[model samples]
Every structure is written in C-alpha cells, then in structure tokens.
Target: MNQDLFDNVRRLVTTAAAGLAARRGEGLAEVLERLAQQDIGPGAFREPEPRSLPVLRHLPQCVGEAMVLDPRLASAIASVEDALQWQQSASYTDDLLGAGFSENYGWAEIIGPRGFFPGDDVLLGLLMLGPERHYRDHYHPAPELYWPLTAGSFWSRDGGPFVEQPQGAIIWHPSMALHATITRATPLLALWCWTRDTATPAQLA
Candidate 1:
C-alpha cells in the first residue's frame, strides 16, 4: 500500500465532507454522521490490490473538467486516482444495459466491504459513467448521496423526469427509491455514499 495514496483518499473523504457542511437535508445529515464515525487512519484499513476499469480512461478528462468547478475536491480525487480499485457490478450486463455499457461504467469504493477501509454499514466511493450512457433505473435498500465532480450529467429519481445537475451538486436517493443517471457529451465522475443498509446491492428496474 502506498502510504501517500492512502492519505490522499483519506483527504478526499475529509475534503468532501467539509464541502457538504452547509447542505441541509435528512439524508445528508445521516451521511455526515456515518462519515464522522469512520476512522480513516493507517491502522483502520487494509490495502486492497489496485485495479482499473475501462471507464477510467475518461477519468483524467473528467477530473480536469471537475477542477473548473471544485478544484479542491477534484485535486483530492486526482491525487488518489492510481490507487483506486475500480470495479463493476457483477449483476450488470451489456444486454441489460446497452452494447457498450460494460466498458462505460464502473465504481470504486473508498470505504466499505470492498474498500480500503471496512465500513460496517456505510459505503463511500466514486462512480463513473462514460459519454452518452444511460444507467437506467435501479434501486437499492440503502439511501444514497452523489456529488458529481464534473458537469453535463442528468439524474432521475423515483420515476421522475431527468434533471440536469451542475458540477458539485448533491443528489440524494432514499432507500428503495428508483433512480437512474444519464451522461451527455461529457463523462461523469462523482463521489457517492451509502449511509446504511449496505448489505443489499442495487437491482435494475
């Protein structure tokens, strides 16, 4: 494990949490509380082998775009990019999504069962979707929060219409609520967190 990489991830989480301080919402409150309880120090985590996915090919571009919106958060992400364990959902398939969906989507956990730090019931991570992709409706038991680092992304929740969310905007999804995401010409790089009920995985609608 690269001590510097681990520290960078820790800083990323810390920086993100700090930026959310002024946001008001029940979901955000719970996420902050859970994040507060996490110990991200050296002794609190086990190093997982670093990995990458096809979607990451666009990460540098996304991060660069993100810097224009939130330099602090974007730089935090860039600092730890090389050490992330990028992965995709085993249940997701090209047939279920789209022909190129497999190559366009992936996630990396910063805190959770599969993450560097084992968070009991909380999950913190990054989710990336390449250009012009639709991650159709999906639902999960846990409440979720997403802070998109880059722009030009649309999100839909609870069978609602898709709304364009700006860079650094926070999107929350309550437990079991249907949600989906779409990306246009620009790819997406977002920080996400699941406050509780982390046992169940997301199921597509």
Candidate 2:
C-alpha cells in the first residue's frame, strides 16, 4: 500500500467528517454520530486497487465549481481523486435507466465493503452524474444522505416534482423512499452516505 496515498484519503475523510459536523439537516445528526464512531485509521483500512469511470471526465469541472461553495472540501476531494475506485451498480443499465446513463454516472466508496476502510452496515462515498441526465426514482433499504458539491442539480423524492438543490445542500431519503436525481447544464459531484441497513442494493421504482 502506498502510505502517501493512504494518508491523503485519510485526510479527505477527516475533512469530510469535520465539514459535515457543522451542517444541520434531516437525519444528518444520526449519520454523523455513526460516522464519528468508525475506526478509519490504518489498522481498519485495506486499500483496493484504484479504478475509474467515464463520468470522471466531469470531476475536474465539478471540483472547480465546488471550490466556490467549499474550498476545503473541494481541495480534499481533489487530493485523493485518483486513489478512489469508481464503480457503477451492475443492476443499472441503459435499458433500465436511459441511453448514455451508463457512461455518465458512477460512484466510489470511501468507507464500505469495497472501500479503503471497511465499514459496518454503513457507507460513505462520492457519486457523480454527467450533464443532462436523470437518475429516475430508485429505492433501497438504507436511509440515505447526499451532499452535492456542485450546482445545477435537482432532486425528487416519493414521486414528487423535482426541486433544485444548491451546492452544499443536504438531501435525505428515508429507508425505501423513492428518490431521483437530475443534472442539467452541469455535472454533479456529491458526497453520499447510507446509515445502516445497507445489505440490499437500490432498485428502480
């Protein structure tokens, strides 16, 4: 394992947790508490081989935009961007979602089964969506939280109308609640978390 890379990711995770600590949102307190208890040090981390996806092409721009909202968070993300293993859900395909969606969307776990630090029934990661894409309604067993670092994104929950969410905004989804995301004009880079009940994957609604 590259100690430098590992240290960078640790800093990123620490920064993320500190940044989230001050923010107030629905279900955020619970998520923060759970995250605070995790052992993210070297003893608990096992780095996976890094990989990436097409959607990462938008990451630079997303990070640039994010700088306007929170430079500390943006810089932290940029510091370890290359070390993350970006992945997509096997169940998501153009046939099920929409054309081009496969190339335009991906996520990377920072703390979970497939991440640098194995987490227990919890996940903390980043999610990206390229421009002009709609991630239609999907539901999972875990309660979720999203903190978008970029702008021009919209979110919908429980089949409701899409509502624009600004940068640094926290979006929460209770367990099994249908939720969707739409990106317009600009791509999205967001921190996402699942607190407990994480065994089941999300299913399209």
Candidate 3:
C-alpha cells in the first residue's frame, strides 16, 4: 500500500476507533489499533482486481433506498457496484437471506484471511446502503463496528429502538446480538468490522 493512502486510512481508523471505542466499547478500539499496522481499510481499493466471492448481487434493495439520504454516497456506492464483478461464495448465496432491503445495498471485504489483507484474522469492509432501507434483525458471533462517513442512519440492537448516530459516528454491536440498520438520508458509506470470531457469517433473524 502506498504510504499516503496507508497514513490516510490509519488516521481515519485511529480517530474513528477512539470515538467509537468511547461510545461503543473497547473491542472495536482494539480492532482499529490492529488495523493500523496492516493494510486493511483504505488500501482496499488499491488493487484493481482483488479476490472476492463470485456473486455480489445480493445488495440492491436495502442499499438502493439510501440514495434518498445522501445522493453523493449513493453515487459512490453505485459507481463501485457498477465496476465490481461479483464472485459467487457462501457469503452471498447462503449468508444474507432474511436480511432487509433487497437492492442498492452492497458489501466488499477489506480485511480478512481471504480479503485484501490476508493473514489478518480480523474482517472488515465497506458497507453501502440506499435510502429508506432497513436491514432487519441479524446476529453474529463477531463483535462489529460501523464508522459512518455520512449522516442520518439508525442502528439498533437486541430489539432496541433505532438510535440515530451522527456523521463520523461509530456504532458497535457485540457478538450474537440481534441488530439492524436503517437509513433515512445520506446513503451510508461506512467502515465496517468484525475484529475476531469472523468464521461465523452474519445471520439474519
């Protein structure tokens, strides 16, 4: 990874990590720290063709609704989606079923054993969602974090009411909690993570 991009990503992760850690918890803070030493988040786009699951088609509905919130972010995600050629894998075909919002939603791996930064057990990605999309209840064993680059997104856990976090806000969910995401404005362009226990994919209720 280029030193400039590396430093930029590190800054984003460190700042985002500290803020999220204070609001969410310590696990996420640690993940950011670990990521600082590796090529995880920003350099994700450094490679022209990185390996990924074959089928990336599962994300359009939920993410599509996000455009109503932030057209710019929606545009960015849409552009990324257009450039991507999905590779089929268990994560696409079998993993995301029952999750809300069918279109305009997408996920790309940034760090993980099979992702941009292989041998880095921690899993991370960029999450794009369209306006008005609701990611219904879901659970996973891995602790998770979200650093929303834009505003107007809501998050909930264990059936809790959705809470709107601000731009640059960090949302964290502990392992196996039933969680969901909803966006009203500024289609989400957020950094996502599963610091550990990434073997278990996300499962929707």
Better of 1 and 3 by TM-score: 1
Can you tell me which runs of candidate 1 are displaced by over 4 Å? Answer: 24-26
Tell how far residue 203 is off in model 3, in angstroms.
0.4
Flag the better candidate by lDDT, 1 or 2.
2
Ranking by lDDT: 2, 1, 3
Worst 10 residues of 1 by lDDT: 19-28
lDDT tens per residue, model 1, 77-168: 88988878898999899999999999999999999877889987999999999999999999999999998888899999998999999887
* Per-residue alpha-carbon lDDT of candidate 3 for residues 9-41, written as tens digits (9 for 90 to 100): 344344444545555544655676766666555
lDDT over C-alpha atoms for residue 21 of model 2: 82
- For all the candidates, what are their Cα RMSDs to the real structure? 1.3, 0.9, 6.5
Give lDDT tens digits, candidate 2, residues 1-205. Answer: 6788778888888888888887989988988988987888878978787899999999999999989987888888898888899999999999988999999999999999889889888999999999999999999999999999988899999999999999999899999999999999999999999999999999998
Q: Which whole-number lDDT from 0 to 100 does residue 43 have in model 1?
A: 85
Q: Please say which candidate is ahead in lDDT: 1 or 3.
A: 1
Winning model by lDDT = 2
